[model samples]
Target chain A: MNLSRTKIGAILAAPTVVYMVIFFVVPSLILFSYSFWSSESYRVVPDFVFTNYLDSLHSAVFWKVTINAVRIGLTTAAISLVLAVPVGYYLVYVSRSQTMLYLILITWFSSYLVRIYAWRTLLGTNGVLNAVLLQLGIVDHPVDAFLFSSFAVTITLVHIYLPFCILLVTSSLSEIKPDLIDAARDLGTSSLGAFFRVIAPNAANGLAGAFMLTFILVAGDYVTPQMLGGSSGQTTGLLIADQFRKTGNWPLGAAQAFVMFVISIALYFILVSLGRATGLIVKRRTINPKGI
Target chain B: MRKIWSTEDILQLHLSRRVFLGGATALAGGVALGPFLPGSAHAAGGDLQIMAWEGWELSDELADWRTKNGVNVEVSAIGNQDDVTSKFSSGNPPPFDAAEYNQGYSDLYIDVLKITKPLDKAKIPNYSKENLFDVFYDKPTWYRDGKLHGVPYAWGLNALVYAPDKVEKPASYTDLLKPEFKGKIAIVDDTLATWPLAATLAGFGSKFPHLTKDEMASTFENLVKYRDQARVISLTYGDAVSLMVSGEVVAVLIGWTGIPVETAKQGLKTEYTIPKEGATTWCDAWFMPPSVDNEETSYKFINEAISPEIQAKVVTRNAAGVVSSKAVELLPPETKALFDYSDVNGIFKAAPLLGIPPLKSAEHATYADWVAAWNEFKAG
Candidate 1:
């Protein structure tokens, strides 16, 4: 009744493979095919033409929105990673109790819509923060800049996805051996230097993973931006949604979405490459430093 | 059409309409409450699934119907009219028996998808053409090939709503830019809601929903003033209501008629007004999907929905005007005041209503352009 390595591997991978084929690959192929079609009035014509893509390319707003999408995605990922690394480090290296870690993780349990609306309540001009500020004499008037701006959307997104980032980074940091850090420090390396030489290189994969995940999530989001981004929150996702919903132009929406998908993949590789280069620097510093 | 009629005319006209609703109500009530008829082709009991906006069910009425008829009536709140198209276009055999969407979406529902059957005239004997306002009942806009495919169930105006204590009575959309109202205004974050009203205020009342790009650009240029004053571009009806309830905004542009009703429940006194330039209006309709099962039940429910009792509940509780002309007679004085309906002509004069723009047609700027312009406007 013993299974071979290959057979076991196949058995383990079979479910995921089936799931992706049915859920991801099939829908993606359909979406890709739709990108090549055109819409006459509200009805989608399945004719293969480059009109949708051509139209998207010709429009300046598409490019502007696409660029804004990437900018916001990258910004959100960078901020989330920056904030997450410290928390991840503390949880893995300093914190002894699982209670604190679980408390932080529990934040994710709240509904996404509730979390977004909570931010809406907090940052609104007449919201709690403004009232408190006014009462405390911090400001004479309620600040209008706190909500319905890109600032509000970014801050909300960072809070929403921070738990996931911390989880990923902590998972990677936990895999590092305590002996490796002790060894580096024992070799005349400073705590900071050892961290750069040993810890950061080991944690690069998790950091990159968090970055990519946060980027994709933030970039494709329409609700957060639509709700909070009063005037400045027009992302490619919103435009794409408008196509399907407001315009009834499914083909154009599909085309816009695929274009973004391609951009996101390209940005992900660039992040990966940047991670590799950083890892190489750390490796060279620890193993083949010019001064050492 | 511009001439105003006397109150007597409305009372006289409403009498016949009330009689029709009374007869239909009795017939529907008998069928619903009585034991199942032996020769009926469609069975009486089954799930009646509906996709609609919030407050469509009128809980008391639904609970009463369910108790009497032994049928489960389930309603799922849809976000917008586009969700209706998504449900239909995903594939044939729509998920629900019926859907509630804007009357103007008939082009997409009836002409484009053909998922709707031409409504059976005999099935909904309560529906009277004279009961509905002319702006919404015009079939060339809502129907194709002269076949009626939907029944207007709910109607409301998109206008400026203001907090009376916080701001002066806003007589026009231009007051959104008053220095005193600065940073205390919210506008709807929608192209259809924003642009039509903006165009009208920019002195393009007759040309609204058909504005040229130059005209739209100029209108948006004017909109920038209001945008500067606005605290938020509310994304939905709830968003607008929240802005008022939270005291984030003293006034809202493109506010739905229901906003004041919701704010009042929150203990905030607010007023909705169609400005001097005019206001835009929308209608929610119920149409059976192509794959509708329990067809008999759907028809019966549609008929019952327009009955005097249900229509009264819809107007008072839900803050919507009933399509049935007779529903006005059944409404309490306070409920009637909410709609500003002293008479039928007053109801008709609520606004120089704007219809849904032809997004799919080439006669106007494409939907993409309108949205893009909004983004650009917001960006600035």
Candidate 2:
């Protein structure tokens, strides 16, 4: 049985493993190697130097923007998840809303570029929102004070990522035995208290997954911020883009990317640990010791 | 009202689901490997491919040739010079034979790859002594040493394309860069072509014969001041058109051939203006590939492209990209009058900014330094 299980796992995993080695691992290694190389105006010269790492770390602009990116990431993740949980719940639960739920899922089908372009049109100075407002006499001229600001960037990012958060939470909610939450109230815990003590813990794993999914999507995005961000709102992604295109500084771009990678990995582990401590992932060996 | 966690709370979901965890891990692994494999074998004598901006945007002649030659040619229309320069310099194996470039960018490639093969004077026989303007035909922009490095492919002016609403006087570059237009302006990003005109505006061009380093320094300073007042620095004609249509920018520094004519039908309030300092004029060449060895086919491609009939069709169908003298005769009597086909007489004579061609290498380095410095200055 053990041998059969091992064989099954390897057979299932071989394609992904081989695909990754060729596409991902090899390229990342090349980038890492180049990060240590010296870059001229447009060409890379292979001389070993730690200066790239030092330069990447030393820039206050780099660090400030990184922190701002993190702040935006957290705020976007939290707000998207917070809103998605209920909207998904209502669709999945009260709407008994399988049809609406399926319709909402259709949002995930639209291509990302179309969605970004649509959002840009809606939120731009002359976009659908401001255009309507002006026609309604709600405001006189176009209100650019809101468009292309960080608020607009974050709000648009949240709107884009909300569907992912809701889907993750609802799928995890689907797994819970509703009987346990009913029993807690059946034992005379108040409805709200039972939700807190019993049901919330049961669905913790889904929330963790939702957070991770939404967080990762917002972090690496280059388009929404690029189109929407005016002078004040440029991100590290834009800087990396300039390095490769405008400045032709690939080594520096690589080093800066590696820095982002380390931060993302660190954040990932922190979230994983916090999830475990909170029983977001209750050591599930007890729940499915043999079946899984 | 709700007793259960209600499928709605992200704060109450599980982690480490089987399929999603697996998908995330797999996706991350796939994205890490980049597009090109930097192996030794792939690097050697690789087919020199270019990604030009307007293979699709321009006329069908490029594709027509591919059919005739029976040699496979792959082309993608990346409609902007930023995309062109980025792709070429990006160290990617871009997919094309040659790209259409302006005088502004021909030097960038020369600086980077030096990958040009001189146009064989014998092969491109239509390249007569009398075809182009005297200054260029006597010594074309791409003419170096004794060999011609590029064929004259296209030419245009960086004249002002202004909205009649924005400017009462559209006759000078200095008038456009005023305080009232702080955030409502557009200009070309090329420093070499624009700076000599700025030097002329600052009266440095007149004093250059008795050239003083301090005078050149002041000219540079005045140009930097001009640079600061403009809001948008566009890299392509398409970008200029977009900004103009969006009403985001009022006046565009456009090549005369592209705007006030090529795109006026699109309902943009457009007029091409010659600055009081004259047009910052330029020319482009059909630069040859050092690695390209199909000499007979290459010559055929050049001669056929610049034939009188084809050149005339190009003036109507495409902008004035085809370089041939006979293109003038083919235009309607009235339309032809609008353009001066005398290469030197048309633009080169009308507004001559007589200034030094600062050493290309020194200019490239100094401008690059200035750009970086300007970015920092602007950020503040």
Candidate 3:
């Protein structure tokens, strides 16, 4: 019952490779092919044409919404990471409590829709926050600006995604040995200096992963933006969904999706480059967590 | 001699492996793609499949029907109106025997997709006998090319729903912009219902469903004020209900009758009022998709849907307006009070009907144009 090295490798990779090819690669290729097609009379016509892309490029709304989506994504990711790092660092380094971390992460077990609606209740004009603010005399009147805006969308997304970011950063931080920090301390470096030089670079992989995951999730999310974002917060995700769900304009939707995909990839590389330049990540070195 | 592999031999091995993988992938793809390949309609036989909007299925009646007839009815609750027409048009064997679509989408369902089939009068005697609302029977919207493509099911209006305690009953759509309602109002996020209602109140009712660019701009100009005064633009009946129940939104401009009915059930003092300028009424109807596999069952389901018993149940459970006049008789006194049936002769007069116009009707703007204008309004 011996297997060759190639056979063993194939067996180990088969499930993932097959799954990706079936679900991701195949659907993506179909979507790519559709991007070049056209729709007439609410039917997807299988003509290899450039009209959809041309129309998307020409439409001012398309670009505005696309840029809006990216802006939200970047803002959400940065804020989530900034807010999560300290919490994650505290849990791992100071508290050393995985139980508390798990408890925080467990809040996500509730439905996403429920969470979004909960935010709506808390942020609406006559909502809990407004009531509290008014009663405390912090505001003379209930604030209409609290909900149904881009700010509400961003705030809710940050709150929803913060736990995930914390979990990712905590996983990364836990791998750092205390002796490494002690060694850095023994070398006459301050705690902040040791954190920057020894800790941050090693946690770069997890940070990058967390940022990308949050950014992509926030950008592609249609429900939160539609529910909380209201009129002001409409994003390209809603447009794409409308094409499929309401308009039956698959080709144009596919093209818009591809455009967003291209923009996301470009932004990802830019972030990676920035990370590298800032000395947060070093080139040609595996981020071995145990030591340098 | 020990065998040594040449580049050609290695290439051949790699090619063989790749070919095997490719074949497996192709087989998997073919199996997946088989269900979606389009085909012609066939007569529906035994198992009944229905696709309808949420709360339109009349589940208790369906269970009773299932018990008596020994037929299984599978219902898919659609989220959007476009879903009804486009779903059967796309799927092979066409997923549902019948679908419930808004009459507003008749152009897409009957004219564009041509997916709806002529109802067999023999199977549905109740519809043929005009037992339903007079407005629905043989109407051009439901009846086209001498074929009865649809039968009216349930109808409702997107009107003003307000908490009577917090706000006085809104008399007009223009009440949305009142100084009192500033920062206390909400509106639904439906362009079709909201636009016409707005246009009517703005003294442009005659120009509705076909407003000129200037007309649309003016209508939206009025709407911008409403939008500014609003707390949130609700996406669904449930969203509005949640807002009303939580005391977040004291009033909603485009709130559905169903929302107040729901909120009232939750013990909120919510009341729906048709504004001075008539609210837009939308109706859902049962129509057979082209690929019906259970024609007998579909017709039976439609017949049962409009029957007094089922209609009363649906009205009570879903708070929907039934098409059948007989159903109004069967309704409990409390339920009957919810709907105004006094204007038996004037269903359209009570609430202005909005649907796709006939192909010959000259219109300055299409639904797409209206959507664009709405999007501009929303974007602002």
For model 1, residues B163-281, the per-residue Cα lDDT tens digits are 99988998877777779888788877655567777777677767877777788788888888888888777777787888888888899888877888899999999988878777676
Taking the candidates one at a time, how many backbone clashes does each contain? 0, 17, 4
Question: What does the lDDT read for residue B192 in candidate 2?
Answer: 38
Give one digit per residue, the lDDT tens place, for model 2 in B21-75. 7888877765665334343211222222343445222246545655655544444
- lDDT of residue B285 for candidate 3: 86
Q: Could you list the chain B TM-scores for each candidate?
A: 0.83, 0.68, 0.82
Candidate 2 CAPRI classification by DockQ: incorrect
RMSD of each: 12.6, 15.8, 11.9
Runs off by more than 4 Å, candidate 1:
A278-292, B1-39, B129-146, B190-192, B340-354, B359-363, B378-380
Q: TM per model?
A: 0.88, 0.74, 0.85
TM-score comparison, 1 vs 3, better candidate: 1
Arranged by DockQ with the best first, the candidates are 1, 3, 2
Reference-based lDDT, each prediction = 0.78, 0.62, 0.79
Candidates ranked by lDDT: 3, 1, 2
